[model samples]
Target: MTGVSFHEFRITDSQRLDFHYEIDSETEKKTGEIHFQSNIPIPFDPDSVALALSTMCGSAYRRVRMDLRVSPRARKVVESFLRCELSAPARGGVTPERRRRGNVLSFSGGFDSLAALRLMPDDTNLVSMDFGGRFSTEKPFFDKFRPTVISTNIVGTDFQRNSWSFMGIGAILTAPIHAAKYMTFGSILEAGVDNLRRLPLTSRGQTFPPFAGAGYRNAPYVAGITEIGTAMILVTYCPEVVNDSLASLALPGEEKLYRKYVLASIAAERAGLTVDLKEPPPPATRRPFGRNFTADFLSLYIRRFGGAQVRDAFLTDVPAEIDALSERLALTFYERINTTIMQKFPVELAGGLYERAAVAGLVPYTEDDWREYMIVRDALAPYHPTVAR
Candidate 1:
């Protein structure tokens, strides 16, 4: 009674269902709805639905003991996540196992996600959540991949915020529908190590445990690559998509910075430098891009190509370096992927997946591929910030 209580979800229509929940002793309950595409009914499993609801809004509660009907496995997953994230002892009870196969990616048609899509199996189901009308423009873009678009207004509510748990909600909710045993996200290296300060990619406090307990393997397909690498891959493989779609999807001030980084990655690769997974030494002082988790990357770039030139090209301040370090200090995209794939997938399957990606040309960097890069760079350069003379 003193914690969050999840009541049954009411099916509003064929494409919509509303979940009602209450805060500690609150008389009036808050309602959240999950809207599928036209004619796709909500999954009938109460346990899965409860897990999805807890993932969407459980953090809004101060105390974390969520009372809901869930299977033992699902309850364990929820309790573990709650304990780790909110430090609350969550309680819940039973649902049948659904046979599942293949993978489902939480696609957003962004640079990082496109990189993930490229690395995933050919049959991996692409699922994107449209936040009301925020992502309406991407619908046509998402169609290129033939993704299942699920529009939901959950993001419009106060509970919506960036969290590891929040990132995979779409894939989790839609995985059962697609019979996908693996839930993949476009989470990149910068997100886990640079932003959250976690390593090994499978650190316990992240989204892996709960996803595993729910019988869905958590696969961070792009976890090995940095945002810079993602941009490079996109430019090499799909410059048109990046120019026509992803560029427009970026926030007002971010597009230029992203382009600069993509250009920097291209230059680095041409110079035969690759990303070193060895964590860079912490900055001597906080930098402007520190809050964005890209300060380390900037430092890496500075080291790769003299600080003065990088600063001038990117039109951003660079941090002072204590000493010149080798690119070996950072994790190459390939090494990171090899480590990550084995952990997230069966070892037998991991090798084949890696091979498939390699055959599909999802390697470290597009070293020799400058034709598309040059076109993309020139086309987007006008928008990039010009360095003061």
Candidate 2:
């Protein structure tokens, strides 16, 4: 990975917002602009907008620089947002008006997000975004609140790596447009945090500390600095949804819904409809909703090594030594990265990433757990680099 530069962000007189960025690496030099068409008038502060966009895309580069001057406040926010991986000039203060239109759920109609929607107050506004070329549908009831539909026009590519880079952060960026008080995601705390505890070495990348903790810091920094609050609704629901066995816990509020589902199940049984809760969700014939390429890449790499291998390594090698197994499994996972494409999320897989996650006060992991995955990832690998990271 080389340097990535942010050139400019402009809202054209034609109600189009444009973002210009360039990536200069040894293998490839690419430059392009992203155009966002807005039907409703939305105020934007150029520096803040540039910072947000740059941070979202800057993960690919070792160095990130902004051509436009940034206010001191915005610079601080950006530093916090990207964990000080970016560079930009700093001046004085410039604030945008925070929307008073109450909370907005960044809905994706996914299981987790839908669960969050059910948990939220009925009046909470729903704001949906479609990146990777998916388009959000308009709901007539939401018209009064001026529901937002963001189309990034990017469906798939090497750059179309992480959905959060666009979808998650993009929702925060829309706060000003929606006059949104809090931009919430359906990120369930129980699934992510519990998954981390149950499978620390093999948990999903986002479930790890550096990435998850960022939710606590980054979103709020962006929202507060931009004059709105950030919401990680799933974190709130974790205690209510997961149990000690690392399985899904029934939500008290959903008991009635569950009963109804049970009755429907009985009806389906009487009608001879094939229904089996033990079976997995049907394989996606079409691209699954909100599919993230980067996560997919990491998951495929992990699955290639066999997720069960981590535990097997533990059972076979360090049956009586939990600490030894923890460190060994961490190193094993790290070494696997040395031979795979999971290197992209280097920092997230690093020891520091998990260490930071440990202190995040979410779910608990043994302090002895190891995570030098990034250090190992940066080391020599046998394959050629198709795209710089």
Candidate 3:
């Protein structure tokens, strides 16, 4: 049943990040360095939070060496910005900020998240989200966190597709169904935009406005006192290999491969930007290439493409010499896919089987329905990465 363990993991994405850690002195705060070289061009201020994520995601980084510094200004800004809450309480209620910071690396309670947790600083508040569909994979991980796992929920509340009919979003290969990060229009979108506005962009300067009316559309979701209760955070997702905490379930390698090279890869890069990014090839045209491709294809087609763009307080760029530091910033997803699957796809049960395909290179370059993606894509422009926007 098992050769190597498939540990599932969860990654809370942020178009930008501002890690407001406690600092000892002045010089310590200003001097921070990310030693990763990557093909992707990174652009942001050194004191910005996106640095933490940039160093890990695309850049194949091993160690994040930084001289811990505290920016009273940046800290106050990020804390006040991200420290808001989202909860449902009626009338007078005593709701306290969740105490344990479940800074789980890979949410499987097995490998990645656990690694992050092991190294997490004391007093860090642990916050967890519950994907109604991903209970099993998510629950075990919570159990691992024991009492520290603070819970929340997410659902695909709505959607709208773009052009597959004419030359709208997709090409001739366009189908009625497609999933790109920008394909959906509600729930996740509303929640995400609200979260972004509450955060600070500069050194406590700009209010970080929504571009293209993003804030206006999702304003309803952030109404009232629910805004003052809980804050959804972006935790660091480090790569770890925990053999003991792996699930037996996994799609085959060949099936996964097809989804990867063809379906997923195209969808993520191509479909997101170009709509209807799939090739002219039919589903039955090829044998399941590998678990990677089949798994990715099935998941993408299933949701039709929601939950692909799970970016809320996403970190933008922080001036990284990525092109030259290619090796430093270059991440090796060669094994992360299998590891995530083995771990049961933490965030969404569908994630293990579905969305993880979106993040990993499986869905490399695909398109969205021009009609559908635009409806939400433009609305989400405010929350997108600086580079992406």
Candidate 4:
């Protein structure tokens, strides 16, 4: 076997058998594939799922990189699978219409957010917050863009002590209290749920209500987006991810990548939008660099390129004090981040929503923004091994 291998396929109609063998010239490995036909197609409960899977086996699906070749007979049988399925059909327009009209971009004055905000209609509200990160530049940036901007500031928890967790080291969970100021628009916030769960509690022992945990919230985006001026909607999807595959990702970024896909997917799905989850789509506006808003890209990135890439991107672009804190907090984080990232690296989070929301949803999930940020993130992960994602 060699590093590269190609498979040859053969099928026998009389026996209803298929055979495949692969020869790798570089890796010097031998592999094979085989299949046998039954009297009929095995019926499935979800016919559309079968179609989706079958369509996914080809290059048509953009969610994952998959290569599955089937015989014409199998292809035909698969085509009929939907007819045999009994599962509930996908409800078209299942997502409720936003009762009102309003557009809210997670405006950070960063390249991506600013660009997104700049492109939105002037009537759209302008909101900004810094999950304790350096996003205050948002207002000034908007000032120059001059798009009828009305902004607010938000503060998040300090999680530098627990940077190695699945949370975004500095991302705000609830977009801070500022979001509540604008939650009355009868609109949806375009951010992730991780941010929703991390609203800071006041001395009164009160914070944003935990709707998902308690079932009090129907729509995390619109109905429960109680905060004013901002909405954090997870608008990404990666078809490859199913269930909680993100938990096992070696780097937090990879897990974030899986979740980004889910978020982006859910966003587009609910909003009747089409997005390419396999790759980073240009921000709705033109920008040189997109803001790293979600944790979706980090996990896959760290797993492949290591946490060093993520570290450099954060420290160089976002003023993350990774180098200053690496030695100081390495061992401290190692004890808490028992899974995923390497614990030896110090990952003092400036504290934000990503950490607060993630500590609870540890079951496992993933995102899909890995390809875009891999370059910078890969280069930086080696220094901060723990907060690699």
Q: Choose the strongest candidate by TM-score.
A: 1
lDDT of 1 at 33: 40
Q: Model 4, 185-268: lDDT tens per residue?
A: 122212332222223322111111221111111111222121111111222222232112222211233333333333334435
Every candidate's lDDT: 0.52, 0.39, 0.23, 0.27
Cα error, candidate 1, residue 128 (Å): 0.9
Show the lowest summed lDDT stretch of 10 residues, model 4. Answer: 211-220
| Residues 127-158, model 1: lDDT tens digits | 77776565565666766777776666666554
Off by over 4 Å in 1: 1-3, 6-8, 21-39, 58-69, 84-95, 133-137, 194-207, 255-257, 264-289, 302-315, 322-345, 356-389
Using lDDT as the measure, name the better of candidate 1 and candidate 4: 1
Query: Better model by TM-score, 1 or 3?
Result: 1
lDDT tens string, model 2, 150-172?
Answer: 55654453345633455554444
lDDT of 4 at 356: 34
Candidate 4 Cα deviation (angstroms), residue 314: 6.6
**Model 4: runs farther than 4 Å from truth?**
1-106, 118-135, 149-297, 302-389
Candidate 4: residue 42 lDDT (0-100): 21
**Which candidate leads the pack in lDDT?**
1
lDDT, residue 343, candidate 3 = 26
